[model samples]
Target: MVEPLRPPPRSARDDVLTYIKTLHGHQHHDQLVAVRSLFTWAKQNGLIFRNPAGRIKVGQYEYAMLQPLVPVQVDRSVAVATTPATRLILTLVAVHAARVAQIVTFMLNDTDLGNRRRTIAGRVRPPDDLTTQRLLDWLEHRHRRWPNTANLHPLINNQTANTSSRAGSHWISAAMRGQDATLERLRVDRQLEEARVKGPDPLHLAEDFGLDEKTAMRYADSARAQLPQAAEQPSQ
Candidate 1:
């Protein structure tokens, strides 16, 4: 007689890992999601005492393939950006490591041009004088174009009166034409640069760039790997 399938025991965690190893890429990630969902539901229903899939770890290499852009690419992307608003947004992401969503949602009140600082996603970041000047210029252009509109965001869609994240992404993509780069890549490049300069302190990453400790560690590790042997050499 054929054996009937039963609820997975804690030992089934091994089987889950084995199954994950057999899959690759997105399929591998998707399988993990499916397993977690199934086990979570089974536990809630009392079909299993614990989630077997909870202990399984997916490898990090798949996600870490997102490479940061070099300095030349960053400059080229900035040069090609079509509009002042788009250029301003690109500069912020490249320089401050600000998220695109945060840029899209930035309001007029968020900026302190006099102080050369801006509140990005609830965090105050001190942008350089050039970035601050670019923003001021963009604001002037925006005011000239939409003198009657009350929208606070400088990068607003004229039709919608507010910019969505998708629209903001499109604006960056349009600016990166011929240059193979994205807002996300620029953000990562900025983070790597920060890590290289600052020696990858998780606290600094968390406080300055608003990244979680774990993510900060990853960036730190990547940065440390890229550091020159001379930099790591102890002081004579």
Candidate 2:
């Protein structure tokens, strides 16, 4: 949620910032152009001395994807995960490639235990056997630890279970602290593993994780790039 600096008034008017925030994706560019044209018109009509919008800067939306970590590193992380909650969090990230944010917001209602499917960010994805088992373990642990807690989020600690708030990203990632692979590295490695085993098709990555096309392409391309390097590495 880190944002670049604001327009400083000399660059653009307040309404332009307000307008950009209301739109999504490509609409930001379209809306900004409209505002710039309005300012240009006002300047030509002698209403304003200068077009602040003319000096306004806009940049294309960008996403950065991390390269996959060594497979053995992630394996060590999974092996070291001992607690039910830690194991479940590791499984979700390593197996399902769930984002920390998405995993944190997950509610008890999001799970269909009998069906072995869970709704994450409005998408229904089935957990593999290991993930399902870890989830059950975590549920049992949570229930035993705090039976009367009203907090709905499935992932909760003593502090969070007492209230309605969910676990933070720092807390969740720190669950695997000192491990070889962090949650982010594990998540990227999951997608890369898929692309390595299957074909490195952007469509497949997009479909699997509900990723945007650009994000999918980056993961796919990284997988394709890593394959040859993996082959070249000396056997241990």
Between which residue pairs do clashes occur in model 1?
none
Model 2, C-alpha of 54: deviation from truth (Å): 12
Clashing pairs in 2: none
Cα-based TM-score, every candidate:
0.72, 0.68
- Expressed as tens digits, the lDDT of each residue in 1-236 for candidate 2 is 99998866533566667667898766777778788888889999999997767867666754444476866887788777879988988888888889999998889999999888988877888667987889899999999999999999998997898999998888888867777688887888888888887878999889988889988888888888878887899999
| Whole-model lDDT, model 1 | 0.76
List RMSD in Å for every model shown. Answer: 6.4, 11.0
Cα RMSD of predicted structure 1: 6.4
- Candidate 2 regions exceeding 4 Å error are 1-67, 228-236
lDDT of each: 0.76, 0.83
Error of 1 at 118 (Å): 1.5
Show where candidate 1 strays beyond 4 Å.
Answer: 1-19, 24-30, 36-67, 161-174, 177-179, 229-236
Instruction: Give the Å shift of residue 91 in candidate 1.
Output: 1.0
Q: How many residue pairs clash in each candidate at the backbone level? A: 0, 0
Task: Look at candidate 1 and tell me the lDDT of residue 125.
Answer: 82
